[model samples]
Target: MKCWCGKVLIIDTRRLESKFRDDGKDGLIEGVNLKDRIERNMNASSYPFRVDDSCHIFRFTSTGMKTIEKVVVFDPLPIPGIYMLVLGDFDEDEIDVGVKSNNRDLEMVLSTVVKIIAFFLSDYPDASIFVEGSSAARNRLYRIMIEKERKNWRELFVIKGIDEDTFEVFQSGKNYSSYLISLCKT
Candidate 1:
């Protein structure tokens, strides 16, 4: 989808996965951290997508704050289907979301994602994205952020969950999440 700040694109999970296997990376348009993700994901748990069937992406911005068009790839999970699940924080961590779909078209899915982000940018000044339904799920989110995003990724970092009850910030490589984390906490 097209937007004033950027464009969003989604492709089939099979196509995305194949690209990752071929090139060792796919990126925001497809996904990220291919080779490392593949090796690490060998034993990653898979969840039934029933709960995720209605998944949506949301973005937010604080009053008078700038909208940084950074896309964070969060909770990248490989489901047993032709797709990989992707969650991300965007507009400089002002927004958070996950994308899940049974649809076959990537563009449609991603267009919707872009629209959702736009809504957050245009509307909600304070909003929270997904947290695990259980403590373990939230903890898993933290570990995933630490393990995958702690490297060469330039402009994105996952928001860490503290104790699955309160949220905290952790430094990922060169990124200082204090400011961003503070925004998220509210």
Candidate 2:
């Protein structure tokens, strides 16, 4: 499959129906599945962000015979703080947040995270924030929360810290989520 952003997204479903049945999970939504199929057929793709160490845009070409020429490129966002948040899907969770960016400024990192949580919670009111790995991660996040509160930034109402790897996978589509999350750890 491909996204309009010109990035190839392939998900073979040769056994998906059987697997869903075996797991006793609800069937896939018809429109969503069809959309995925169309995306694959169209060979849509995108690279919303730049890949580090590369001067070129990420190109996603379809394996099929489609004249669809989708080009994906990176766009750097300016939030006046550390880190960036990208959205993606996971098998185990409905929503996940990852911190990405090497910027060591702790204040910017926390502010970015709070902004992400606030944005997501507006739609996913029941979503949880999962911090991964380090035991002290909770304490670090809390400290940032307190500081943000003092600075008059709205406190996030939902957060669950998990491990580093899980956050990494959820943030696969987003390149900056984990880097900022790591800044909070330090």
Candidate 3:
């Protein structure tokens, strides 16, 4: 099957902060990283933050599609902090978030992810998105994807436990589920 995904672009935490700084935003305060601010606010200097809150915007250009790939954090996220967007052929749009251990960032990135899909839908012609997460986290991933799809596309996008489940639910529609998860050593 021809994949709807195209190019991938990762905007890390540092980059987002830099963008905010350049854009004259204020969320990234005091030149201090969000992770540090959270830690300081809790008065737990060594306390680990929940997860890196980053935006994963998917942009479909007239040439190719683009998506986020990494998050730069001081205390690196235990989740897939480093993501390598594997470009695929016309058959599928593959984004391999090389997750060696846990997938804490997966859920956090979903909100931004949906918008990217929306970009594809509203902006691109006959556009769709395909997600491939590890089986360990596919359930949660599927849940979030499904919720977003349902809200936007109604039953038009039935993302279930896996990609197949999603495909089975709504065939010939926007297939937005994962086929496999990535395992990284680094």
Candidate 4:
């Protein structure tokens, strides 16, 4: 599928296991890193896609402010799959989410990921592109931002569950999300 963001993309969200590797002195694949193979086809002649494997933690300035206010760098995880699992926060009311996704075609996935991110770019946006076993699924959730719903929407992230915790994090975020992470195994 192709998006009007001057890029063409494709997603093949197939459940696959790969050797997990990270940035360290010794190069080794410790355990099997689960992945959903989603490929993005970029038509742009030159696009910068070197910003992968970086985690951004969005912290709020206020106690109950929606959306991401501040972003911070955090420790990199060994795993790759996009785990939206919730961890207890320093403050009980606050919630912390760690995001990471295993990459097969890094450029394509990241490019397409930028488009999928548009879904959360609005004040009240409801849409999701998911990877479900070798295919991309698009669910027109709530009121859409764009006039017409995306017909050729592609999957950028392969997720496990759309639980309440995950929903809360996404919904609470303003225009950007701190829970999103892009990881690369070097």
Model 3 local distance difference test score:
0.32
Assess each prediction's global lDDT (C-alpha) against the native: 0.30, 0.30, 0.32, 0.25
Q: How high is the lDDT of residue 7 in model 3?
A: 43
lDDT tens digits, residue span 82-149, model 2: 22233322222221223222233334334433433333333334333333222355445544453335
For model 4, name the residue pairs that clash: 8-41, 9-41, 13-134, 53-182, 53-183, 67-173, 67-174, 80-102
Provide the TM-score for each candidate, comma-separated: 0.24, 0.27, 0.33, 0.19
C-alpha RMSD for every candidate:
17.7, 18.0, 15.9, 18.7
* Residue 10, model 3, lDDT: 49
Candidate 2 lDDT at 144 equals: 47
Off by over 4 Å in 3: 1-96, 100-108, 152-166, 170-186
How should the candidates be ordered by lDDT, best one leading?
A: 3, 2, 1, 4
Report the C-alpha lDDT of model 4 over 116-159, residue by residue, as the tens digit.
Answer: 23322221122232221211111211112111222222232222
Winning model by lDDT: 3
TM-score of 4: 0.19
- Stretches of model 1 off by over 4 angstroms after superposition: 1-126, 135-138, 150-154, 164-167, 171-186
Q: What TM-score would candidate 1 get against the native?
A: 0.24
How many clashes in candidate 4? 8
